[model samples]
Structure formats: structure tokens, C-alpha cells
Target: MSCNAASAAGPRIVSMNVCSDQLVLSLADPDQILGLSRCSRAAGQPGPAAKARTSPRLSGGAEDVLLLKPDLVVVSLFDKRATRDLLKAHGLSLVEFTVPRTLDEVKDQIRAMGDVLQHPQRAQADIARLDAAVAQVRAVASAHHYRVLPLERRGFVAGDSSLISSLLAATGLTNAAGELGLGAGGFASLEAIVQLRPDFILVSEAGNHAEDEGRAFLLHPALERFYPEGKRIVLPERLTVCGGVMLADALDRLTEELKRVTR
Candidate 1:
């Protein structure tokens, strides 16, 4: 079936990816949303998760999405290729979004989503809020120079192209991964990390609790020995996973965490 442009108000929409789910819930009218991805309701998802409860959740299956008969389906580039291909074969109108690695890209995406949903004014308002929050953090961050490394599960470091790296730059902190010779992101050996000696290690969580083996790497004895307590910045996975309305909150949280560690 051929699809027409979205109506002035918007089209009936279903979001098949977790990140797309957040964007849809943030920008689309309640009446426009036909369904959201199941992961949108997962614990710790915050804003999107709360809103998702009011809508039906899909399991990212073409069959499930077909059942919704939505006028549009939004997805992430990383979403299952098979599912996306199936939807396209069935002549569904689909909008696919790439993962944003920088603040500018994030802003662009918010506006794009708004345009797709036929809510340009709402997108502008959201952009204004995001700009304001970023300015607030930038003002405080400009006064100090610190080196921060976004170390995630399994000793992987966020590269210069990652959102976390962009956030660090916006906050006036240097990304330590570059100093350690991993400009594009790669696993830093425990010994390499210890040598780099970043002023702070930005992690999704703190404390000794390791939810799994991947998490256990974050709590390794060497990491603790080098960057203990105040040196570890906890930004939470929810805020960093998606670039959407929650990004403002992520900036605020990062600014506070930076202040806490620097003090």
C-alpha cells in the first residue's frame, strides 16, 4: 500500500525500537501512538517507560506491527533487519533513525521526529529547552578542566563519536579514551586504564554490586584501586542510552556528577 504524507496533526504511529519509542512518546499525541516497543516499559527507563504504560507494547515483530495497522512505524537503524525488511515488503510506511552521537545530532533528530509527526512547533519548544539545559551545564563546566573516561560494561570505552563523549566535551571535560590511544573506542586493558589515570571514570552505576559478568568488569579491583569513590561518576544507563527528551535530564545529572567529583 502506498503511504501519504502525515496529516497536519500526525499519523497513527507505532515505534518498534526502544529509542524510537522514547521519541514517539515524547513528541506524538496520545491518539497518534498505536504501540511502542516492549523495552520502553522496562524498569529504570524513566520518562518514556511511564508514558509507555498508557500505550500498547510490541515485541519488534513484523506480525505484531502489522496487527496494529499503523499509518507509520518508527525504528532505529540497529533494529532487526529481518523485521524491518518484512515490514517494507508489506508496503508499510517506515521511518528509521540512526543513533545520534553528538548533541547537535540529537537536536536535529528531535526536530526531524517532530516534523514527521507534524509538530514543528512542539519540536522547536523541545529544542529550546534542550539548548537552555546545555547552556546551564556549559557555564559551570567551563571553569574547570578534567579528564573523564566513559567506561562501560566489559572494559569498553566510549569513543569520540559516542554520545557520552560528546556530553563530556560539552561539559568541558576531556575524553580520556583519546589519551589512551583509542580514538574510535575499543577495550582498554586493565593495565592501560590504570596507566591512563583519568580524573574520573563515568559509569552507568557505582558501588560494588555487579549485576552480571559484564558489570563485574566495571568493579574490577584495578579500576577501584585507581579511581575510587569520588573518582567514579554514575550517570545511569537510562539517560545515556537514548537521545530524546530525557537528554536534558542527562545533562543536568552529568553536570551535578561532575561538580560532585571535582569538589
Candidate 2:
């Protein structure tokens, strides 16, 4: 469905997850965002996920969502089913999308959500802008020779099929983790990481606790012995969690840090 046609009535959208938060906020105008989940809001900033919090804060319950009187509710499949049931009971229109695992999935979700919001044109434009930003960063990476290792101690780092891994490849860096035979998901052993010896580490800030554990792994006696100081890089999970314009931000930070190390 093309967003070229103008709709007199725009849907009031409520986003329930971080990935959805990025998509819903980007495509909808301020007035269209009826509510945003509290998880989207990060430290000190008005939700790292949402561009701006024009929507009412949703605390994962049906009570406040009912108050929004939304025309459309967007949710993640992983979110509590009780919330979905409650919203549906009120006869509100609903759309659900799985967390994106590939860049193509990101684009598909954008287009799909845009169609639902009656603003496909805006979604196309936003996606184009996001693509351009990714290309810009990729151009810079094309000129360099960097080995990237997606780091996750508690969970396995991104692999060949993962979105984060695709983003790393998008920037022209080789993911050493994939090279050393870690498949598409979950925790990695310290010894395996040592064997990879990546030129740079792409640690995803899954959350504060996960980020802390990842950071601590860097300082572990075994890991430290393997990787010299100053070779590790920690990137906020938001940047790599989903394919968005923010990827350029991650590339900029990663490239800068990698350059410093290689220099």
C-alpha cells in the first residue's frame, strides 16, 4: 500500500516495545503517537527509542491504554498476551510485529507499519534517509581494514544471520566471531573469544546489567591476557538492536574507536 494517498483520518498509534518504538515514532506525526511504553524512555533523555515522547506513557497495562482511546495499537509478539487481550476486548485495532532480525525485516516492518498508519509515503522517505545514512558509514568502512567481533558474554554475540552482524558487514568490517564458527545465536565461552582475537569488539548494551557483565568480561584475567587494553568498544544496544538511521551513529562511533586502535 502506498502512502501517496492522503487520509483525512489518521490512526492514533501506541507503541509497545523498543523496536516498535523507533518505527512508530519515526512514521507517525506527534499527534498520531497516542502512547509509548515506558521501556522506550532511557536515562535522562526523553526515551532513547522515541525521537520525542509526545505519547502518553504506557506501563504495560490495559488501564492507561484504554484511556488513550487509540485507533491503532502496535505491539511485539513477545509482550505479555494479557495486554493484547485487554486491548482487543475494547475493540481497538491492533497490529503486531516480531522483533526484526535482518535489515530487510527492518524495511519490511517500516513499510508495513507505515501502511497501517496511512502514511506509506512518510515511511518510504524515512527509510531512504536511513539507508543513505548507513551508506555513508559503509563508505568510510570500505576504506578501512577492520575485524569486528560482536561481544556478548551472557548471551552469544550476533552471528552471520543476525541483524547486528549484518550491520557490521554493512560497514565493510569482517565479523571475526562469525569467521571462528559461532552460529546465528547465544552465549560464547571465554576461550572461544580468546581464539577469535578480534581487531575490535562490538559490545551491545542489551541493558545496564548485560552491559556491565560485558564490560567486566573485558577486564577478566583470561580475557585481559588475550586482548590488550584499549581494544574493546561498547555500543548502546539501541543503535544495533534494530536497523534504523541510528546505525550510522554506531558506525561513526565504531569506526572512530577502531581507527584509534589500529592507528
Per-residue alpha-carbon lDDT of candidate 2 for residues 1-263, written as tens digits (9 for 90 to 100): 12232255577778877667777777777777878877767653223444554466788888888888777788889889988998898997789998777677777888898898888998788678667756766666767757878776553677787877776776687777666667776667888777777776766442223246646765567765655546666677656666544555665666566555666
Candidate 2 error regions (>4 Å): 1-6, 44-51, 143-145, 205-214
Candidate 2 clash pair list:
3-120, 41-47, 156-186, 156-187
lDDT of 1 at 221: 87
lDDT of each: 0.85, 0.70
Query: Worst ten-residue run, lDDT, model 1?
Result: 1-10
Candidate 2 least-lDDT 10 residues: 1-10
For model 1, give the RMSD to the true fold: 2.3
- Collision pairs in model 1: none
Candidate 1 lDDT over 3-76, as tens digits, reads 45446547889998788887888898998989988777888874655578999988768998998788889988
Against the hidden reference, what TM-scores do the models get? 0.92, 0.82
